[model samples]
Target: MADLPRILVITDRTQVRTTVENVVRAVCKEAGCTWVLLRDRDLPPLERRRMAQRLREVTNECKAKLSISSDAQLAADVGAEGVHLQRVSDIDGVRALLPKGWIGVSAHSVAEVRLAKEEGADYVTLSPIFPTESKPGYGPPLGLETIREASAIGIPIFALGGITPRSGFSCVEAGAYGFAVMGTVMRASSPGKVIRDYAAAFATSSSRA
Candidate 1:
């Protein structure tokens, strides 16, 4: 897998007042975001593929990477750099389908993270790191300590759920390789600024380290 970006922006068109394409363009072009995970699962397959293809063009124009969530076939069809799978997904199946492509898995616990690593996932998004209105049923926040623990398992961990620009450095300090944000950037009036802030936070953390 290629070196993963420091920020992974998950798209949710319903949460955005503006168009998803506009936000993605802003983040990729202005904020220098290198990775985008298309997560509009509620859309019909045809519609979702159309959206993915559109976003792929935007990302490609900005020299960024695009990953389709839970859809290896769509990722392949649209020439995405990766496929982000649900925890219950068959990693091997996706591997066979997209042999050279990146594979990211959603993991809620250290056990799941370890399992994902064992199954050859290139990275994992460990979610509910803080109280998130976006995924209330994910239960309580996993806290920074969990980030520390999960990162020790030897796979890159992207802190997810309720992650904000302000909290980016904290997750990095706790050993997270990056952050995965949805609602924060999706609902932002200036999505580029949010992405820039996240980059700034990571930069600050690196300087301190």
Candidate 2:
């Protein structure tokens, strides 16, 4: 939408006390939440499609972009805005399939960030900037400098993992284009407050944030 969204809510039903649909609808009531990645990796195609359809409507109502994780064809079929690819995913193939929408990738380091940039990813989620309980095995946190280094790849880089409203500024200081998170919005009891906090942090440091 603006090259990329400033704040993205990564969805996971297991991580939240509420349903994914409810969480998306709740946090996206404001303009701060510009993106949602529907990441239910365990559901069957039909069930996931139905869920995506429900989320798609909510995103539309809020004027936010909705993307499904790791499924280009399914994303297209479900009327999502685009697809977010895995680290080892075939970008060229997915790009061919999704010739008309946003295509983002997961990256863990500077090399992968460069790869995504070189291979033409619309944006990349450079993750585990902090040790996160949700991603115990994604390697140790990369810290702020790694984020600064990765941002040189010339693609929009979103800092992921253990991102709270308090920590979002560190990402901006480290040169993150924005931040992507799950629990900050999903598990939040006061999701609107957290969302606004994130927006404020991003905005204070960025013109578009």
Candidate 3:
């Protein structure tokens, strides 16, 4: 809700959960990041719920929002900030499962962006502004032009996929509201420093506007 850079750091469940979660919480707290998207794929329902609960505890300490990628019901159960819907259909399902205050959607194209906005998403992730390893063979990356087009639709667009400290600011310049990074921050040798650099860049850009 502050006028700071909206940085959304995503957690990969494939990594060491406790270490990653702790590091991310620390980095976000220091950098004043807006939210952390906990993308735990394919875990059992109960385990996912537990992970969300733990993440909620850390995020609460940091005063940052935690958005779970799946299990909207579990997200609500654990008092998560929101749920990130991967598919369009999941949007309605999640909306119904979670409360009015908690819902986001992933958008790969302008159409999806419009649909997400129409579906009453809190924010939408528009991805592949650069080629990313996360979604192999998904399609060619939608460059900054697509992001500009989507952002013009008046919805808050979080640029995702292959976003790094170097490219993150450019995403904002291209009309994105923020940047969502997984490998860029999570896999960084010094995530704290990387987050600081990213925040600095976004702050500089914001000041020039």
Say which prediction, candidate 1 or candidate 2, comes out ahead on TM-score.
1
Q: Residue 35 of candidate 1: its Cα lDDT?
A: 92
Q: What is the lDDT of candidate 2?
A: 0.84
What would the TM-scores of all predictions be?
A: 0.97, 0.93, 0.89
Pairs clashing in candidate 3? none
Sort by lDDT, top down from the best: 1, 2, 3
* Per-residue alpha-carbon lDDT of candidate 3 for residues 3-111, written as tens digits (9 for 90 to 100): 3237778887564434767667767676666678778767787777777778888888878877788668777787877888877677776766675545778888999
Whichever of 1 and 3 has more TM-score, that candidate is 1
Write down the worst ten-residue block by lDDT for model 1: 87-96
Estimate, for each residue in 1-209, the C-alpha lDDT of model 1 and write its tens digit: 34788789999998898889999999998888999999999999999989999998999999999999998999999999899999645788888889888899999999999999988899999988999978888888999999999999999999998888888889999999999999999999899998888888778987998
| Candidate 2 lDDT, 1-209, residue by residue in tens | 36677888888888777788888888888434778999988999888888899999999988888898998888888777778998645778877777877888998898999988888888999989998878889898998999999987778889999888888988997889899989767888877778888888866777654
- The C-alpha lDDT values of all candidates are 0.91, 0.84, 0.77
TM-score ranking, high to low: 1, 2, 3
C-alpha positional error of residue 105 in candidate 2 after TM-score superposition, expressed in Å: 0.7
